[model samples]
Target: MGDFVKKLKTLKTEVEAEVPNHPSIEMGDVICEHFAISKPEEKTVNNPTRASNKENITEKERNKRRKSEKEKALGVKKKQKKPCGFCGEKTNLHTKTTCPKNPNARRMPKPKVS
Candidate 1:
């Protein structure tokens, strides 16, 4: 009878430790309420690759990633574009009228030579 009483006391203590003092509210709910945070919304199933592929990324990010990948897989990344120099637009941040060099420009005196 004494051994049974000792076992019951230990079991009662274990139950008290596991259970919250409050009967109506749970521990996690209490924390969320104190912080004023709503319960997290459930997320739907997602396609793995669609998210990464559709992100709006700048050219610098693309180029940096490409260079690192190239260096890892192959040898060194041979050539890299300077800022705004990828498509031969080195002199960026200018309007078309004030451009220093124009490939399709004609001579000043249009018909003098002929």
Candidate 2:
């Protein structure tokens, strides 16, 4: 038991020496205590680039971000009303998606042309 703990502690120290700022090596004392092993005194380093648990951005900025996200989600959306793509004539009846003139389009009852 003692030899295993000594090996585990040595292995941990070697790993810490290799990667001082590793996330897994952050809570050295907690890990040691959990495994019934004692660790030497070590300085805890706080990451400078880490974000705080607070909302710093403005409401307008947040709204703008949300608007852009919505726009991206609904990218290049076609207009409900547009000119006939197949027949190449502007009309109120249908667009390319619903145009009867389209060869590959499903059989649909086309409006009467008078």
Candidate 3:
């Protein structure tokens, strides 16, 4: 136990020395930069085509583009979702060993086996 603690303390000191100034960045500065409060001039999108060219587009074309953009923003594409594996159900939910209905969930051994 003493050796374990000594080793842990040594490792802590070494890690601290290796990672000095990790938090040199101020959180306020980062938030301001990210939320565009401090530097509004940094917005590179000077002329967004969607809003700028809205007057030129026809009603049908505008509706189609708006529908596609809404679908993309909501991740409603046909390819992203697949069937669930647990019950072989056609669902968009995720499938993994942790799924409750998965038969294979109970087959994996617990940590106690080690």
Candidate 4:
């Protein structure tokens, strides 16, 4: 009887410690509750290649991921165009017309005769 009571107390403390003090509700859970009343059904794929494909992604998705990774490696961020060094105007790349501070904004000078 005494051993049983001690086991019960230890079990209760273990359960209490396992549970979080303040659990956060996940955004996915809220979205699923709003749109999908029931749990989403999971389908198992049989194809080994499809299952083991790069992060289980299609070829197109893999290509897009690779491109984005390459861009990141090259230190390029999407949707954030760099401002021109000559002018402070935002442009993807510096151009003669876009850069007001460019000295060669006008037409190139004619070649000098020898």
What lDDT does the true structure give each of the candidates? 0.54, 0.65, 0.60, 0.61
| Model 2 misplaced regions, further than 4 Å | 1-81, 107-114
RMSD of 4: 17.7
Best candidate, TM-score-wise? Answer: 3
Which digits, one per residue and each the tens of the lDDT, describe model 2 over residues 1-114? 999999999999999899859455558767887899886568587568745343466756754543444464354343344567787776656667667778777656346433
Q: Clashing residue pairs, candidate 3?
A: none
Q: Judge candidate 4 at residue 54 and give its lDDT.
A: 31
- TM-scores for the candidates: 0.22, 0.22, 0.28, 0.20
Per-residue lDDT for 73 in model 3? 45
Residue pairs clashing, model 1: none
Q: What lDDT tens digits, residue by residue, belong to model 4 across residues 10-114?
A: 999999999878767788888877997755478665555443433356657765644445565455434467666567766554545545467766543223222
Deviation in Å, model 2, residue 4 alpha carbon: 99
Q: How do these models rank on lDDT, best leading?
A: 2, 4, 3, 1
Looking at model 2, which ten-residue stretch has the lowest summed lDDT? 72-81
- Per-residue CA lDDT of model 1 for 4-109, tens digit only, reads 9999999999999998797688888899999989776786766687344445677677655434443543442233423332234543232233333544333321
Off by over 4 Å in 4: 22-114
lDDT string for model 3 (6-102, tens) is 9999999999899866656788789997988875556766675455433466767755654445565456435455565665655444455544577
Among these predicted structures, which one has the highest lDDT?
2
- Total residue pair clashes for candidate 3: 0
